[model samples]
Target: MKEARYFYVPNAVTETELPADEATHALRVLRLKEGDELFLIDGEGGFFRAEVALTTSKKCVYTIKQTLKQEPTWRGGIHLAIAPTKDMGRMEWLVEKATEIGFNKISFLDCKFSERKSLRVDRIEKIIISAVKQSRKGWKPVVEPMIPFHQFIDNCTSAGQKNICHCYSEISKLDFFTEANQSLEEDILVLVGPEGDFSFDEVRYAMEHGFKSVTLGESRLRTETAGLFAVMISQLARRV
Candidate 1:
């Protein structure tokens, strides 16, 4: 018996040949040959069992043998919107780990004190795709482009539990896990601040926009750590 290989194919149904990047991996890295079994994920909750139908120096074609859809392990939606870190590596690590842990969406914020105002989501998306394939996740997390702090807050008008984590001492906040609604199927959104943290006014604005103030723990955490911490807490709260 042979182990199964997985590839990211956006439209596996209508497409026969793997995407250029995937083809390169299949042909050069993995050296997949004709009739070899592999799996495909569309990144939109579609999983497929496929077999290599043809192999060429520059092309790898596959035929869908069976559709293997996977149900999400967790309930409800987990959304984390945070200011990107100054170092791209840290932010990239967060995206990769968060995808492996399972989350529905991620958004980048441009905060007043943020060190990095702009980000290229393309590279981050590629990291996410690789993580999804490695983790065998059926759904891919949506990475929204970086938007202004106020604008992101204003647009969060959905009917779900919302929260903001900040480092302000004077402000009162509940423990994230304790404050989060325990109902597994409820939608949840958590906002994490940047390295310099969200300004007092931004925190106030988020609160005014229906986001509750929450705390991760006693130990101070960096921007990326806080973001990942929030994601973990949100997912854990739903399990109780």
Candidate 2:
């Protein structure tokens, strides 16, 4: 049997046809017609086996034939918070790889040394949606806009398994893999600094607010690389 085409559709329970963008792709690009088989990913851990019921100039109406509740590959959520690189293309690549590797959320940080000030998350979200479908992931990762470093740390005070990857020789640090391995079934959040690295004050503040200082490794990594590494470690740790 031929594989079914997968489309990301959110809140499609009561909806009849694909959204404007998805519809255009289905109609013009894929040339999907009535009676074609498709899989709808709701981005909420739901996989619906559906049949094309009807097709209009810009619509792909579908009737769900089966509902599959597939479990995520990893055990708990992995939230990667990083200071986005000045070159957004690097961040986009990181987000794509991290999504394919498995992560739940990604947040941009505006650190004291951060080169990039503002970011539009809509484009990043679209990359995430595409990655979800490409990777056949059960859930879609969220892309949050950049927030001040101080505010980001403060807000995560109550988060479970909070860790920060930094290179502060004077400051005591734990290995991220070791720390993450201990909390297999808990939601983990990791903070990666910018290329310029986190300021002493910022690192100190985060440490004071329950964010454990951790090191990714001895080798220095770029901001995007650090973020992707954190996500990869979190995903691997959870599977252990």
Give the number of the best model, judged by lDDT: 1
lDDT per residue, candidate 2, 1-240, as tens digits?
966688999976778788889889889988998999988888888888889999989778999998888887887789999998899999999999998998999999999999999887998988998999999876998878899999887778554898888898999999999999985888999999999999999999988999899999999998888888888888778873
Model 2 deviation from native, Cα RMSD in Å: 1.1
**What's the C-alpha lDDT at position 162 in model 1?**
90
1-240, model 1: which lDDT tens digit per residue? 877789999988999989999999989989999989999999989999999999989999999999986887777899999999889999999999999988999999999999998989999999999999999998999989999999999998888889999989989998888876555678899999888899999999999999999999999999889888888877777753
Please report the candidate that would top TM-score against the real structure: 2
* TM-score (C-alpha, index-matched) for candidate 1: 0.96
Candidate 2 lDDT trough over 10 residues, lowest sum? 151-160
The TM-scores of all predictions, comma-separated, are 0.96, 0.97
**Backbone clash count, each prediction separately:** 0, 0
Candidate 2 off by > 4 Å = 1-3
Clashing pairs in 2: none
